[model samples]
Target: MESSCPSTPRWNLDRPFLTGRFHQEIKGTSRFASDAKGCPLDSFSSGLENPIGCYDGAVQELIVIDDLLFALVGIEGRYISIKRVHGKADVFSFQVDASMDLALQEIAKRIFPLCESFLLIDEFVESGSQFKNGLVNHALAAALWALLLDYQAMVAQLEHQFRLRRLSIQGLWFCYQPMMGSMQALSTVIKKVSANNYAGSAVLNLLQSQAKAMAGDCAVRSLLEKMTHSASIAYLSILERVISWFILWI
Candidate 1:
């Protein structure tokens, strides 16, 4: 036994060395401990526990419609704006559901033609050199100008109601829907006259034609008739003067 090599020390299974230290290190660095500290498990549990509440909050936030009606009519407002490029006014600065957006765009298409027609007539009149005797054209321009003012007043009233919280998006859309046909008809007549360079009697004749084409019971038909009569007054007066002079000469 004295000649034997030095004996190797054996690890004791019942009392392992540094067992507490190893456990402490593993506890600090374990995957479960890291995940808990990083809040991944807490977030997963919370999401599973109250997903419906989160969804409801999101829906509530999204349901508040803003500036949709004003934008449709090309008015600049809190949530929407307009940009003019190359004489074309374009709406931007807001977004909504696809179907709603499309509907607004369609309404805008009807509204803008009237606006453009008004501008075109205004510019034509203001140019001052385009007409030799512009009394009739001036009368037509004045009539269109008055009509535009009335339309704008109605829009302002609606905007006031909306601002006071008395009108909902659906209600506004319903209120505006009936005006589309009238606006389109007026735009058509104005565009036709404009395209023809507003020749003599063009505006009055087109207005009469459009009025006749409309339903007899229609309010816009009556309006067009009134405008035609008003616009023709100056032309009629001029014709009367010419006839009187011719009779005196004869």
Candidate 2:
């Protein structure tokens, strides 16, 4: 009888957001890297196991694809993706059960809240003359933010309809490498936009364009007006911290 406990053997994103032991253990598993024939299971035997999850060496078609996914996904949590992990000709459409899905959500909710708490709560203090948000100083804040965003991306993938169309870029959460450099990639994208012609406020135009491109394969989420107002209030608050500093100097 197959165990109904959601065989997340390789994806136990259970409680902790990140751990060093998880990274060390995940380094071994075999991934679907080639057209090789055999039980993919045998490939996983020797690898070590970690608490976050164990892997059998998740492989990919080209090294670049692995790197790309890692940058896109690994920043949030530890990932080990082998493109053809199960010998399936098709990639993507990898479905996780509802239980696994909800567990991942729970992690995001609990751990990620630290960020909002720091930013919104009164406990954090101003850093220096520049008035930096105390939240940024928390070592875990960035990790928490990464975990939150990555979880959202993973959830975004799950929220998708996995029809057989071109193995869409789902399953990004499992792609991993130490320091995947997702931020650098994101930074470069912004730099390119700023360097382009008509740079002023063109950023907004560029975002609109990109949003249009993403709309083809993604759903647009609408936040309630109250939510929008709350977000704006927070942004204004972050900005106010800086503004207040400048005002003090003036």
Best of the candidates, lDDT: 1
Per-model TM values vs. the true structure: 0.56, 0.25
Which residue runs does candidate 2 get wrong by more than 4 Å? 1-34, 39-41, 46-212, 217-235, 248-250
Tens digits of lDDT, candidate 1, 1-250:
3235333234322342311111111112111101122222222212333221233432322232344444444333331222333222211122222222334434434444444343344333333122432566667667766766776687788778767878655565577667666665766665576566664587677888889899664888987887788779988998999999999999
- In candidate 2, position 61 carries an lDDT of 19
Best by TM-score: 1
Q: What clash count goes with each model?
A: 0, 11
What TM-score would candidate 2 get against the native? 0.25
lDDT (0-100) at residue 57 of candidate 1? Answer: 32
Q: Scored by Cα lDDT, where does model 2 land? A: 0.29
Q: Tens-digit lDDT track for model 2 on 106-203?
A: 32332222222222211111111011222222222233344446544753453342232222233333232212232222223233442452222343
Candidate 1 achieves a global lDDT of 0.49
Estimate every model's Cα lDDT from 0 to 1. Answer: 0.49, 0.29
